[model samples]
Target chain A: MSLRRRDFLKLTAAGPVAFAAAATLPTSAHASPAPDNAFDDAYGVLVDTTFCIGCRKCEWGCNEANDVPRRARTEFDDKSVTTVHRRPDATAYTVVNQIAAPPETPQPVYAKVQCMHCNHPACASACIVGALRKQPEGPVTYDAWKCIGCRYCMVACPFQIPGYEYAKALQPRVMKCGFCAERIIKEGRKPACVENCPNEALTFGRRRELRSLAHQKAVASPGRYLDHLYGETEVGGTSWLYLTGVDFARADLPPLGSRPVPELTEKIQHGVFKNFVPPLALFGLLGLVMASQHSGENGGK
Target chain B: MSPTFRRLAWGIVVLSALHAPALRAQKVQTEAEQRSHMEMMKLDCRQCHTCESPTTTTPCLMACPRLTVAQSSGKHVVSEAPESMVLDKLADQYQGVQFDHKLHAGMAEMNTSCSTCHHFCPPGKIPACVSCHSIEANEQNLRQPSLKGAYHRQCMNCHREWSHDTDCNVCHLPVGKYAQAHDKTDPTDIMGKAHPVVVAPKMKSYVTPYAKGPVVTFYHEEHIELFGLRCVDCHQKENCSYCHDLSKPQAQKKTMEQVHSLCSSCHQNAKCSKCHDTVERPAFSHASTGWSVGRFHSRLECRACHPTGKRISKVNRDCTSCHGGWNQSNFRHAVTGLQLDETHASAECADCHENRHYNLKPTCAGCHDDKRDFKAVPPGKYVTVSRKR
Candidate 1:
């Protein structure tokens, strides 16, 4: 009878062990489906740098949408404003830097640098406070209340975007280009930057659609541009992709490979941590043996 | 002695013996000792360090006897140092142009060299300036840039002098103060180069009040008309900082009055007609202007609401942009801290209070005109109404 009882316990332990093994496997055969999320919507943008004239209309739209503070002690109507090239600030959520090309065939390339809203956002993983999170609708967004203002997200970000408000003494916030996550993802509309771009330089759509459009634009313009689509496979995939007429190297953008940043780090972490399962199984077996041994000892007494 | 002690002694003896020769040779190096001993032979300095013009023959390879051997033997001598032969040929063929080594070295310090002006001809050949200059203006090297590109790249790139004219005549003039002897055909233009605004003009500064240092002499006048900066071009309140809050004295004290004066001086006068269409001359007469400084609050443009030409004028200051006939329905009362509490006697007046006009019933009689028989409860007269839901 004791041997039979031991067999039953063994079966119970084997069942869980098999299940845990399957869980660690690459295929998610028995795993639960991914949670329904707005980010699952998979929206993106096609930024053709060739078309951008650096008009700064999208900048104004972003400022209006996000309520960012203006910096230069002058009004927007002042023409001398565009002379000084601008970068993304706490108030200006998005900025377009003017990159001057060669003199003879001098064409000014305006590169719009903003949040890439990565598919597997490193910012989301780095945020221990859960302030920065990848929303279900495919946009990495910020929750102001949850942020402790550690600014870890800024450092972890490969793009080195995401600015902090130094002046606001009482309640400062981590300001960044959220793909207008609040308006677009929540309200089901295009981002203010995309909608406000006068030259139609910024196009909003899905990641799949953006890839094809970027490819078509690149192929159509021969010798006019570097035949490469930035961000299609960079840092494992970004919602925002760019097509430029000049070499991207000149723009100081990194040559990121296809592997998602978080996956590489998480893979190593899990490899070390997955020892949990074997230890857990041993514990289960030990518990069963101890319980049976104790029961037999009691009966004999 | 023990074995360990004997081993230690042997180790010390061996170390001393091994280092004895080096220790004997060690001595402080005198300045005379540092001088090149090759001076005893009086060999030409240019033998190793060849300096040559960037013409057909590189400065280093000029009159170099080893160059022939180097070429035949297939040993590589890659350098731009002027060759003694090239210098001799230049002295004979070309006039004595005091090739200022000091100036050229100074220019080279600011502007990078070594690989820029010269190249090692592959298959063991010396690269010359003419090698690059031989290729005519094409897609690769735009037509405007000539061999003068080398000269200009040196001049314009290393030009730390910002106060003077950056024209070619400043440095390379045939008759100018720094002009060398007899290459009157303008050696500055050697390789047929044209200067195309070599150095970018320094930008003008715009004056700002808050700036602690020199006033930012912003070149507004040039950029506006020339760059076609439109009315809405830079009015971007997002990119600039120039607002002043005069309501709170302590907070307002630190605020520069120049911010108000400079901004209002330009903005008030720029397009006043666009804001105030109600009156022709913006009525100087106080009574003719039906607009009250303390009434009719709205998020109207500054020019629209503040019609008075005076520096300071009283205007309704409130968070009633929506309530004052401007149907900003998107605006939330909750944003202004105006959430109503129970008892309906107004939970906190100052919390939602503003200097702007609002149709809030100031007294109980205002709302309950007939219910309270048009009588208002005076100050200190407390009234409470409780209803069980």
Candidate 2:
């Protein structure tokens, strides 16, 4: 009776092991669908930090357009808020932080922070249920319906942009800059912050064109801008680009390599489970050994 | 037969000898012909040519001095140049901006002159933007902007002040589409229209939140027209958003010290009551300040009497305050609108008046007791009252 029980347990375990091996086969066979090419013609914004005057008009415009409850108009003009470095949160999708310039520079520089909208987003890869997707038009969109209240995207973002609505227990969503995707794609308008910029500090156009323009500006005015165009190559390029007079590190930007974050994770995953043969063969051998043991027990009986 | 051949050979020899000198002279003339006609007029080649014996190949003429010479004295009238100019040096992505040369020149007459735009012009013609600014990015000299940057900076500097619009489409259209889109009217034609007169405000009042002095009245027109001050004189570094942005709150709270700096040059800010008052202050009048800048002093620049680096109101208003030791000998008596006659020209200033106040009517009692009433005799006929003073 014991021998029979052992045989039944081995057979039942083999069924689940075979199923697990087959699940990873398709993913290992093909690479993440060759990162969608839809973002090729997508638009981008070039933020020339030197030109920003720290007026906080972009903050006001964003609040009005996005329907984010805000203080009085007079409160926005209070520039004392820039004394401390602030980040995008549940309430605000974008925030402008003032970076104090060195004594050699004329004035302090203001940098607007928001989602970078990476070309190959790690956030989309981290989502277990396909809740997050990088849109063809350069916006990384999130579907609240598909989300299972997992904050995986928050952890995956290199810029640390995604904010979670922790206060809402019923239906929480990840919040970040959507690049005004709906306004740009459907309404044929520039992003609210970009439109509100009085100084023309933020130039919105096709990503390729803006890249060339950023390079041209840097070349034209040496020393006025740093040699590197931020986001041009970092994290395999991003929709938003930046030009700064001082080092990007001083402006609170993180130094990152050109390789996308998803590339590293995907490469490791694919390498270990190439063709799913290793896991499948190991499980098959394990099941066969258990079956032999059960047959030996039966022979003893 | 031998004698006849000898005579013919002798004739040929004579003709050939004569033509040799003529051929040599023609060769020399051709060599000199290469020299410009102007070069021939200079009897002394050393004046321009550096070398002792200058030839066509090594004339070694002095480098042209026209560039330096033209900087100080070149005066090309606006009408002499083209009415409009198309700046297309860096027009790969955007259509070249149309510059209305005539209209800008006309408007420039108000404050600035032709040199405002023709900054590096030559003697007879306006130089192109590329003349001073290099078309390519010049790494060696980063102080000067490249041609594209230079053009944009020049246009946007002034355009940003008035229109406050920096949209690329405002000044630039897509390449190859501008001409077709503009159709009957060119960019220059639109730009050629005169800018609407920027009306100077007669008065402006600012109600500050300060407890000491909340209200500040600014005599804008008086400061501009009467004081002969330009718009940029006080409004230096003013951003357009200060006036154009309606969504923004009121001007940021400026410290009392910061507000004073703006008027420190002309007015004494120490006197808080001068600017800050409960009611609107009347337009500034010299008479109200105890000394009227009368007809004679009105034409003089404020700096002429006040001198720079000092407040205008702080300077002494008395005539003798500036003209230190005024008497008969050194003083040009006619400047006071009263030309001294032969009788009084040599007379001492103390002879006619008891008090030295020149503004007070002079009493002829000391010099001419008989003509005690000076109304009977004028000092002299005004010496054509030279307005040059």
Candidate 3:
């Protein structure tokens, strides 16, 4: 009744092979279908760069809401801070950068940088563990418990929005703008930044609606705005749209095509393993090899 | 049930379902037919419906975009429109904003056009903000703003110019606060609402922090009365925060360049000492610079003498600078309140006048000495001229 060394090895080998085989079984019917239109009703914010006066009230509001330590209210009035271009970091979820205006624009144009909250977020796709997720509502949220501190989301983001808690020794989380999901869904309030904007430069609404509004604004004021809306098509249409008088590139926004970041990788992945064929075949071969090893060992004994 | 009975029952149910829409259509057609002959003649069917043969089920009504420009007579718009309105759409968050419609209308007409506020007015009547914009935030169309946002945008457009502060309390009361907290009893009633008349200050003196020239005197009333400058001329692009909401953040210390931008159009910024004087300077007067704009010249525009970009001091003060070759024949002595008689008119030009400066009084000492002075022997008939200065 005692187990032999060879038998024990065979049992251990069979475990992974069997598990792989089971994982590869076809379940197309149960597979959740990709959404027909992910951004149909998702909330979005349209940021009109021309209207932003670089007041930095949004930054102050964000800090106050998120409980980040900041300087006094009077210190926020110092416009000299805008001289340097800044990126979102662990302390700041959003930062406004003043860009040199184009010839058409009368004054310096300011662009707010934050997570775009794309419909098909690359960060979600890049996360090996299900840490980063594109919520049904518009935010690309993070689950710190699931995160392994891989820093893949940071590299995957086209805007380089996600920041890692490199300083934390344990349980580091990826940080980015959450679009005030809790306030919007539970409290029924606007995002702190949107509420604090004096000029109403940022408009919060449904993604689909914001897209058309951005278009209409650009059309209505021919010379006032650049014809293109930044997030309308870039990286499969982000939730946070932008209207700028200058080219988006000049405003420190990355130039990206309309294709979603996950599209190319998903195509290659699905192509290699369509209908659960290739993975199933590999598992089958592994199982056969393990079975042959068990038989060969028995015959030798 | 028998098969034939079951079949007949199903047939009746199917027939009734099919006929329901047809019956409704017939009723609608009758209603359309019942229209008066004159009413039918007035409107073309295509005006409301897209198709030639529109029925109740497939009416194919055209969507009214409501983008047409509104036309209204100026007189009717003022008379028929309400004097004020209570914008209470966002009352849950803040008390209703009482808009003084008449005051704004009058101000807008004088400064801008009526179309500034009545942006989407149709013929005859002013349209409500909701006519174009939706009341609900979740409305499908995003082209126009929600009613709350539209109202704020319209009001802020002009309000921000006078007051830079965007504090909601400037126009609304906090949630639970009574409107009677202020002098006005009813916030909605604007019948007696009037902005306190803005009195022009005679002068404004600024003691600047500048180490060099610290005092700057701005002649406010003189610029309006004497210089004939409108309020908007210097107050262009001013925000409401400029006068209201003093608690708001003070404007940052202005640079020399920023300080000069205000009056650079009229005065030369290169001459900084002119404005930034060490001591509080007196109000600007034409006489302070040596040439006095007398009664006859008070009504003339500055450009008549200074011309474009010409310094005020650069103008010649002598009468001959403007009226060249002014001898007895062409001089029209009657304009001076004394018409010269034939005897004195034929005298040399320098006999009575000390210098060519018309501002100096004419003396007859050179011609007749103390024996027969200008008072003893009148030069001509005296004319009473009402001088404005």
Candidate 4:
């Protein structure tokens, strides 16, 4: 009985050890089926901060377009709102924040904070049930019906852009700037904020061309703009880009690296569950050991 | 191909055609050369005219000249420009801007000329802003600013430097509603605001920071009236923002170095006391130096007698200092209202001018026994001459 017990322990330990080793190998049997979203001709917006007048009309336009509650037209004229820095919230999809500049300069820097609509959004990667999807057409779209209300997406967003409808007791959903995806992708119209801009500071075009345009503008007017383009490679490049006169850090725009956010987590998770081979091997060995042990016991009887 | 792709190709051809002149610009007249010729006439009729004289009816207009964008302004005086212009092309939400055309053109003359705003034009013509900049932004060409952007950029470039006011009401009155209810009789209701005509100061006195001497008096008119300094000689260094910056309502205090920089070109080697004093100094006078610059000398420029260098050397009280070269042959004594007789004509200058002191009256007692004065019994007959005080 002691010898049989030792044999059972050896078999069980060896099975798991072999299974663990197999998981480390790159699996050909269970290749990921996630759609390739590295699109080249995706639409984007180029924001020239040098031209922005900080009118806050873009905020009003965003509210009107996204079905968010809007105030009277005159409300946007109240520039005192810029006295305090603001963030995009559940009620509003975009907010223009006034950055402090040298008092002598006539042009004041304003940053329009919104969802970056990253090519590889961490929010979509964090969503366990696929409620948030990085659409091939260049938007991280959310489906409220499919959402389990896990709220992981909110925590995972690098820009802290995702907002949860915590006020709603039922049918609460995650909200963010959808980049006016329906208008841009389907109807082929400019985003409401871009259309409403009096200065035409926001330019909507192809991502590749805009990238070149942003660089060209910076190079052409070296004194007017800093060399840095904020979203060119941040989290593998966002659909929206910024051209700022001030330093990116001073403009409230953080510099993130070129690596995609999903690359690391996908590798680790995909490795463990690849082909379900690890679980199968461990269970198959356990059943065989128990049957052999039972037959030995019967013989002993 | 898609319609959009075809349109892009067409746009490329159009843009290339617009800039085609730039490629063959070797034979084109340089801007400075054009300006030199244009300076002779206020209006650049020469750009279009093949003949020297262009009449009202027969301008003698040449074939359209090959002109570059830069040399096209051919800037003229403010009088040639319209006093005011009504810009109504893009006026949708606001009233047409009643732009004081002459006022802006006048200001531009102080620094850059018409080329500052009139960036694009034919060789002789001053085209409207709408001529080149399209109503809609050119999607195919990113360099070309739309009409709206061009208008705002031109105004805001300089206005923002001084006023820093991007408010719509600054330039445009609202079109509809209570906004159009302007009072016609009210003085403030006048459209096309004008800069108050600047009255040049005669003099300016300041109590400066110098410990030894505080008061500094500047003779503003005398520099131009007496010294013959043009306004551009000193005014060229400073820009409009020096006085017009609204954010800084009060003019800034300057350091000694900063103050001297403005006057350094002329007063490079001047002493501190030359400008600064414990009390405000009076305007300069030759009388104070014990030598009166008489009517004839007063008409002459200060540089004519004084050394035109770092320091102005004083004229010696003795007449010989400047008139040393003058002798019997060159003196031409007839200028003194006396035509010398045969006897005195051959006499040495010292015979009448004792000790060569020409300031003193001539002494006749040296030759004549009878006591005769030069005023009564003259050496020669008096001739009518323009020898008046």
Worst 10 residues of 2 chain B by lDDT: B64-73
- Docking level for model 4: incorrect
Clashing pairs in 2: none
Task: State in Å the error of residue A166, model 2.
Answer: 2.2
lDDT of 3 by residue, B1-389 (tens): 99999999999999999999998888776566535321533445564567777655776754332333322334345656788888887687567878888777656544535666665433344667776666665345545556765676677666644544344556876565323333333465332459665566899999887768988888888777766676656665333334554555566888877876877866765666877888888777788776677777878877677774435548776778888788877777877787788888887666777775556766777756566667667888788776755
lDDT (tens digit, per residue) of candidate 4 on A92-112: 898888887776655567778
Worst-scoring 10-residue span by lDDT in model 3 chain A: A27-36
Q: Give the TM-score of candidate 2.
A: 0.44
The sequence of per-residue lDDT tens digits that candidate 3 reaches over residues A268-294 is 566456687756765777587668777
Q: What part of the reference interface contacts, as a 0 to 1 fraction, does candidate 4 reproduce?
A: 0.07
What TM-score does each prediction get for chain A alone?
0.74, 0.81, 0.79, 0.80
lDDT of 1 by residue, B164-257 (tens): 1223233433342224432244454322233232242334443433323334433444334333333334443211012222221243343544
Best by lDDT: 4
Model 2: runs farther than 4 Å from truth?
A: A1-40, A270-278, A285-301, B1-389
* Descending-lDDT candidate ranking: 4, 3, 2, 1
lDDT of 4 by residue, B126-163 (tens): 76777667887666655456777668777766765675
Off by over 4 Å in 3: A1-38, A48-84, A103-108, A166-170, A183-205, A216-224, A263-301, B1-67, B76-107, B123-140, B158-389
Relative to the unseen true structure, what is the C-alpha lDDT of residue B6 in candidate 3, on a scale of 0 to 100? 100
**Which wins on DockQ, candidate 3 or candidate 4?**
4
Candidate with the larger TM-score of 1 and 3:
3
Scored by TM-score, the top model is: 4
True contacts kept of 2: 0.00
